[model samples]
Target: MTPSARRRVPAVHDALADLRWLINPRRRLLPRQPLTSSDHAPNRCARSSFVSETRTPGQASDYEYVCIITFIKEASTTLRRQQQLADMDEEVHGIVIVGGGICGLATALALHRKGIPSLVLEKSENLRAAGGSIGVHVNGWRALDQLGITGELRETADNVTEFHDVWQHENNKSVVVPVRGELRWVKRKDLIETMAKNIPSGAIRFGCHIADIKPANPGSHGAILTTLDGSIIRAKALIGCDGGNSVVAKYLGLSPPKSFPRLIVRGFTRYPHGHPFGPHFLRLRCNGLFVGRSPMTENLVNFFVGVWHPGGSVTKDPIAVRGLVLEKVKEQCSDEIVEMVHDVDTESLIVLTKIWYRPPWQVMFSSFRRGTATIAGDAMHVMGSYIGQGGSAAMEDAIVLARSLSRAAGSGGGGGELCEKKIGAAMAEYVRERRLRVVRLSLESFAMGMIWATKSMLAKLACQAIVAVLGTHSLGHTNYDCGRL
Candidate 1:
């Protein structure tokens, strides 16, 4: 029950497991190879020979057998930890992150705050600006607040709540919902840039795609990564924040990303005179299609249209798509909404694609982790942006993930075995706390989607009653805090 004996046993257990992995690897935990002189270092620093003090001069031959027989019973824990570390060539990193998106960068910063070294591998040459505007409610703000990057984002970000939301029912009646704490509409690029500023320079390497990942077993060596450039890197732990179409997901044998039911065409319209809507949350429904105009800066408006085109293809040409979308809106929406569409430039950039996501059934039952490789953001859980909590949930993942890992690293030993132990515990904690909340959020998101596209008069009435009475306040995930790191 002594601490030294306990430590030595775990170290020996790890050393044996690593030996098994080194020998067969395909056999999992099967033991095949025994340690050699090359596999381990001698315990030369052991307290000047305990046998020397307990015996006479003629007992030299008896020392070797005595020491070998009671090795585990006598060795100190610190010595065992040192011997475990000294057994290998020094080529492993403390942490390696896959993808350089918001969650990836935020996780790196969170680890950095705790003074942990990490390397981020991004497949792209520069920052990605794929997803459109992200609306972070109260809980999302608190997640980012923990990272300390929210203040800088506020300077250039537009408040969606300041103007109020104008909800136009299918019956041509409009209602404005008053704002409380403000929903900030920040461009995807600006938010990424803001988060990137907080990350240490050179921490991430561009164009380094992870081609293959080999995750290690518990109490074994670190994971091995083979990049597209054919470079090999070793790390104690691997975190996957590689968006929905994740390579790491494939490595872990998880389910593939599923396509959402709607066709979406989203973009920003820049007006020199601020578009005149101020902070109004502009929305309209026409012929069962959903159109939302988010209030941005004094001059910008972010808008999107969704339709039940289950098998339809989204066109690549922005002008053609915009024309098609506005034509549909013009046929069913008010003159004011049509006029707002007119202000949008045909050549402006837009995102036109199906939102591929995992269903609640899949996410609820899927494993968020396997060995040292675990995921966050769109990779781990993907849902519609109807609730606008995607960004906040990603931030929370980074915080919780980092918090778990940091706690593990601080618990006594600091070798590969210790790292393996810590990472497993940390990922378990992250998954245990985050899974249910995301499931509820995904349910809330699905409900919103169903309500938005419903054209039946009775269904619309029910939707209105449910929304007016419950809103999003009753949903459980939105109230999460992610606690302190």
Candidate 2:
């Protein structure tokens, strides 16, 4: 047996033994009668009666199998009723998710798992993920496990085992901080396509822009979503998984506090044959500027090079922007790195220029509960990409929300006893519990970006020294407790 299986055998045997004692009539200290289909039909034989009649000489030796099968059928019937009630009580027939990104797709998948149907609305006619590769850590993978979507993500991702390689550009001196656990990296597009493929064909409604949203009924608590085409979709709830430029945020009148001090330039390119780094480790150059490299696929490496350009100076010229980014990368990198950036087909490179924001963590939990709406991921808390938590956190939110909603709906609590009040209370509870952890992560991401962007020689030296000493210690710990709900 494998080591893990061997270790678990004792616990498994103990559990079976305890179960046997509980079920055995002579050994049971508590009541020990076989459950019947109905008390009124006492004359009717129980399902177990058939088990005894159909059993062969050898089959009668295993009472556990009979009991387990009977119990499962009964339990399945009960669960079916719960699911029916959840569907009957659903306040919204259609759901409109604003963003077409990873978080938006994940939320849709979570809702679909509960058999709660939704419509994912994207403004773009064709699906396109924001450029750059993303890392899905252990906690993120756990959340995906709950959604039954991890396998899909795994198929398209490059499995990784380390945080990053820290190097000084001038000296080329580097040290590796081993990550405590494994992680997966994928092009943002791969994740999006995986999620989109799993959803029902008609589930995601693309080319639909949301212009305004307001309460459909002032006191009744339904919402009306005004689309760019001037059509209106009235839903029980609206989820603003929309990105930083989210119109939903604007419509809701929740002005997010600005947090991005620099314009971020990100994209992917093929590394040359003699590239300095390998696929297993992520490499970061920490000079006056910060550039990162990681495997997007077997042949391509995703690199993000950033500098502190004021928001207003970030115009729409992709060529000019690309040149400026290449120039900054050249300032701190060697010839090979420069050649990789230069070799990138300018037409294929994706460039995004925007000021980042870190919304109050409390916003994510609070926004959706108030008016048939809630926000998740970047829409709720926009932070720099330094910590690689944006997509993971969003997926986590979807998992928790799905499980909570499923339980509430399946228990016959959805429409009758469940009521809007109970639903609101549950949503509020989710927000309260999740805010602290996501907030801490947002703050950590912001701090990392600041430290990486420090330009003063003294400050940079001090920051590097601190990281060299404490960075490994802070590498791979994240709070992932979606199972609590």
Candidate 3:
């Protein structure tokens, strides 16, 4: 035989021997421990020791049967060792979600509620909850209820009863609009921790920075994610809940969210003796700038200042930003509001960032999905905080995405091919359901952002006319029901 044919003989023999062992009714189970753990090294050594003891004394050492048995043992060891190495190279997951923020945690909890498991990859070493506070309107509360976390969060903040709007440009005119539904300013950290606590342990893997994302090989449905550490993660369904500058969004060919040339600084202030502002949401628009304040609790107040800087550039130093915010606050706000801004806790001030939002057209026409991979939260439709809907919209995405995936999985559970096809179809359904809802929000926020930034008298009058026609309470987007998971 040729040299190549001689080498093939052992391979063929090993395959046949493995086939025999697979069919053996009394194959040694005790010696064949799982090869996925650290203990496998010692177990393999123990299995090798068994070969000598199982020998037949009456048979010669050169017997054909003895040679075959010895070769089989050696082949099994080699094959198992190779398998262990391959396992270390790749990790297979059912649903892999990127980001561990509110939206990501909410998605995992929502899936957990539907009996579907998922894995969350967070690039940060800890939760990204340092952004101070977020306002949760009625729609957000509804989504939180579906996640079974509303009650616990309710204890952290009280529902706002009224919205106080003061137009300083119009002779400091005050307009008090009664809040129609639940509105609460919740600490971003509280929301993250509460949702995370409900999810299964070990579901979230931190410090996993994704380096690249691509479609799985042809005939496969899902995505292959490579982390910064070079580990490969194969996900049957990949959900990108990563925020504004999402890597997955770019992979899906989505443009990054555009900045609105507005700088916003949000933070919390403590009143040890109890704050005088009751349950109220305050909005003051003055001198082409905006200042907002709301009571999270009797003693803790949350506030934000919006400044229109043409270049969207602001100082990165915390001290410098604080000084700038205070200087701007004095130019356009009352003594009380200025005092509140000055009293903001030193460490509570979030770094200044430009307001960002996806355009309505982008929200209307983006594919949002490729195979079984899709996006959620800010990655899908990042709208400005002008409408107080960014956080609520992310929660809404979590519920709808989870619900769609659960239904598809339930209907097609028998085969890998069927399940993959169903998952892709499910992603399509999720995008369809969320597209229109997010578009309206994006458009409204975009318009409002322009109105806030424009210095033209004609523009301000037109904005007033639109607001007058729609009425403060007539904005029905907040009354939306995302339904149960």
Q: Which pairs in model 2 have colliding backbones?
A: 368-373, 368-374, 413-418
Candidate 1, which segments miss by more than 4 Å at Cα? Answer: 1-91, 162-169, 217-221, 345-348, 415-418, 450-477
Residue-pair clashes per candidate, as listed? 3, 3, 0
Compare candidates 2 and 3 on TM-score and give the better one.
Answer: 3
**Winner of 1 and 2 under lDDT:** 1
Ranking by TM-score: 3, 1, 2
How accurate locally is residue 403 in candidate 1, as Cα lDDT from 0 to 100? 85
RMSD of 1: 13.8
- How does residue 10 of candidate 3 score in lDDT? 48
Q: Tens digits of per-residue lDDT for model 1 on 162-200?
A: 333334454666556555565778878888887777788
Cα lDDT of model 3 by residue, 227-270, tens digit: 99899999999999999899989889998888777777878889
* TM-scores, each model vs. reference: 0.74, 0.71, 0.80
| Model 2, span 1-485: residue lDDT tens | 46576355533433354456656767664543443223112113232342333322222223445445656687799999998875564435445677878888888888887787778888888787656678877777877787776776787766665556667755767666655455777777777887888888888878988888787776755577777766767776567788877777666566764665565556667655544555455566655566666665666766666666544656657677778878877777777668767877565566656447664444544454565466677777777676677778888887776566555556655452334434445555656666876766665665565565556778666655644553423664344546632
Best by lDDT: 3
Error of 3 at 251 (Å): 1.5
